[model samples]
Target: MLRKIESKNMGSSNLGWLRSKFHFSFAEYYNPDNINFGVLRVINDDLIQSNTGFDTHPHRDMEIVSYVIDGELTHGDSMGNKNTITRGHVQYMSAGTGVYHSEHNLGEDTARLLQIWIYPDKKGYEPNYGDYRFNWKDRENKWLHMVSSKDGDAPIKINQDVNIYSLELRKGEEISFPVKEGRQAYLVQIEGNSLINEIELNERDGMEIVEEDILIKGKETSHILILEMSKED
Candidate 1:
């Protein structure tokens, strides 16, 4: 089954300095029926204006992943890690026991990022943080394996039964992804537009695929991210 969700239907907020679109029930946009997709809990599309960003915040028992789409995202955490990452870069933080972090856009242009939260396999893990500045050409017209479970071979490891793949497919390019039995996947159209199995999706749109293989054709130069995990059956 393929379920498409329009970008407009998702929860959104704009506080002048910060603009966000919440993929699942979060903060001031709670939806009891739309809480989550399996263990994948949240996907927040955020755009922070220049010279502003999120201040120190607390999180615990959640695996967080932030993917930068444009501009610069500066990150600071209690673990003594402070770094600024740009387009195509990713940051991972396992707020197992607890942690405090801040995300700021210190550049001139507005910074855009997708902040994702997934429930960890189990709680009370040692808080840790890591990130990867991926090469821009690596995902061109192909899938780039970014994050995976501890047993999987991705550069970034997290405490979950999930795998994340990214693609910067050129216009007219076609690709295929297989969702095996007993597993499901969530596709995030971060930029551009595309048609997945003939279902049209514009920028910021999302889809849920359950145990089905999908063929994607780029309607435009598309930036796509897919997270595959065990089915919630």
Candidate 2:
């Protein structure tokens, strides 16, 4: 099963300096029937104006990942770690018991990012934070393995049985992904346009796939994020 969600159909919030599209029920967007997909809880597509961003915030027991799409995103947390993540970079945080963090765009241009939240398999683990700067060329015309529970070539680690991939494709390029039994996936188009199994998706569009393999073809230069995981009961 493949369900395509148009970019404009998702709930959105515009707070002047900060604008966001929530893929699941978040903040003020509540849809009980659309709360989550498998263990994937939230996917927030955000654009932060220059020199402005989210102030100190609290989170607990959630596996958080942020992927910078454009400009730069500066991050600071109560754990005393601070870093600026640029395009093609990823930040991961395990808010086991609790943690406080702030995200800001100090650059001259607007910053775009996708903030994702996934449920942890078990609670009360140690809180931590980390990031990886991925080479753009690695994902060009193919899948770049970003995050995973396995320990081989994945750049980041999370506390869930999930695999995350990043793809940068030229026009007319195609890629195939297999969905094994009892597994599902969620995909987000970050830039340009593409077709997934013949279903058109524009920038910011999202799709949920279950129990079926997927073939993605780029209609134009496209950047995509994919999250695959075991189906939740």
Candidate 3:
């Protein structure tokens, strides 16, 4: 089954320094019926103004992954890790026991990113942080697997039974993904326009796929992100 979620219908917040669209209950966007999708907790499409960002905040028992879409995002965490990443890059933080971190857009322009949160298989694991600077051409018209369990081959490992992939499809090109039995996935139309399994999706749109397969065609050069996990909520 496939369900398309238009961007216009999603919950949104507009602070002067940070504008965000919430895919799940977050901050002021609370909905008891829409708390999460499986273990996927949150996906916040955020735009941070220059020289401003989130101050140090604490988190625990959550696997956080931030995907940089444009401009630059600088990260500093309690683990003594500090780094800056730009478009097409990924930053990961596993807040097991607990951790504090800050995200800022210190660049000259606004920064766009997807802040994703997933529940771990079990709690009390060790906290960690990592980032990847991927090659743009790797995801050009192809799926670039980026995140997975520790046993999997993705560059970044998370404490969950999940797999994450990305693609930057050229205009008019086609691609496909399989959501195997007992598994589900969420697809984000991050940039540009796309038609997936006959559903038209514009920028910032999302789709939920369960125990099925999907074929995506680019109406324009589209940047896409997908997170696949077990079917159980």
Candidate 4:
């Protein structure tokens, strides 16, 4: 099964400094039917104005992942981990029990990023923070293994049985992924345009896949993100 979600159809929130599009129920965009996809709870495509950002906030029992698309995102947490993640970099924070953190864009250009929240397998795990700087060339024309439960090629590890992959496909390039039974996937077009199994997807557009193989062809130079996880019973 496949369901395509247009970018404009997503829930939107426009604060003075922060503009966001919610892929699932988030903040004020509550929709019971659109709450989540398996263990994936939230995907907030955010644009933060220069010199402004989210102040220190508390989170618990959630696996938070941040993918910086443009500009720079500065992160600071109570754990004394502070870093600026640039494009092609990923940041992960497991708010097991509880944790406080802040995200800000101190650069001159507007910062664009995807803030994702996934439910942990169980609560009360230890809180942790880490990040990885990925080389852009590694994902060019092929999938780049980013995050996974089994820690081998993936640089970051989470507490759930999920795998995350990214790709930067040049025009006319194509890639395929097999879908095992009892598993599902969510895909998002980060930049440019592409066709997922012949369905067109523009920037910020997304689709949910279940029990079907994925074939992605780049109509133009495209950046894509895929999250595959176990299907909920």
TM-score of each: 0.99, 0.98, 0.99, 0.98
Report residue 28 deviation for candidate 1 (angstroms). Answer: 0.8
lDDT of 3: 0.96
Rank the candidate models, highest TM-score first.
Answer: 1, 3, 4, 2
Name the candidate, 3 or 4, with the larger lDDT value.
3
The residue pairs that clash in candidate 2, if any, are: none
Model 4: per-residue Cα lDDT over 1-233, one tens digit each: 88999999999999989999999988899989999999999999999999999999999999999999999999999999999999989999999999999999999999999999999989998999999999999999988989998444588999888898989999999999877899999999999999999999999999999989989999999999999999878
Kindly give the stretch of ten consecutive residues in candidate 2 with the minimal lDDT sum: 149-158
Please say which candidate is ahead in TM-score: 1 or 4. 1
The CA lDDT at 178 in model 4 is 71
Best to worst by lDDT, what's the order?
1, 3, 2, 4
Model 2 agreement with the true structure over 128-196: per-residue lDDT tens digits: 999999999999999999999745358798999999999999999999988888999999999999999
194: Cα error in model 4, Å = 0.7
Pairs that collide, model 4: none
lDDT of each: 0.96, 0.94, 0.96, 0.94
Root-mean-square deviation per candidate = 0.6, 1.0, 0.7, 0.9
1-233: candidate 3 lDDT, tens digit per residue: 99998888889999999999998899999999878999999999999999999999999999999999999999999999999999999999999999999999999999999999999999998999999999999999999999999889999999998999999999999999999999999999999999998899999999999999999999999999999999974
Clashing pairs in 1: none
Q: Give the poorly placed runs of model 1, Cα more than 4 Å off.
A: none
User: Which scores higher on lDDT, 2 or 3?
Assistant: 3
Better candidate number, 2 or 3, judged by TM-score: 3
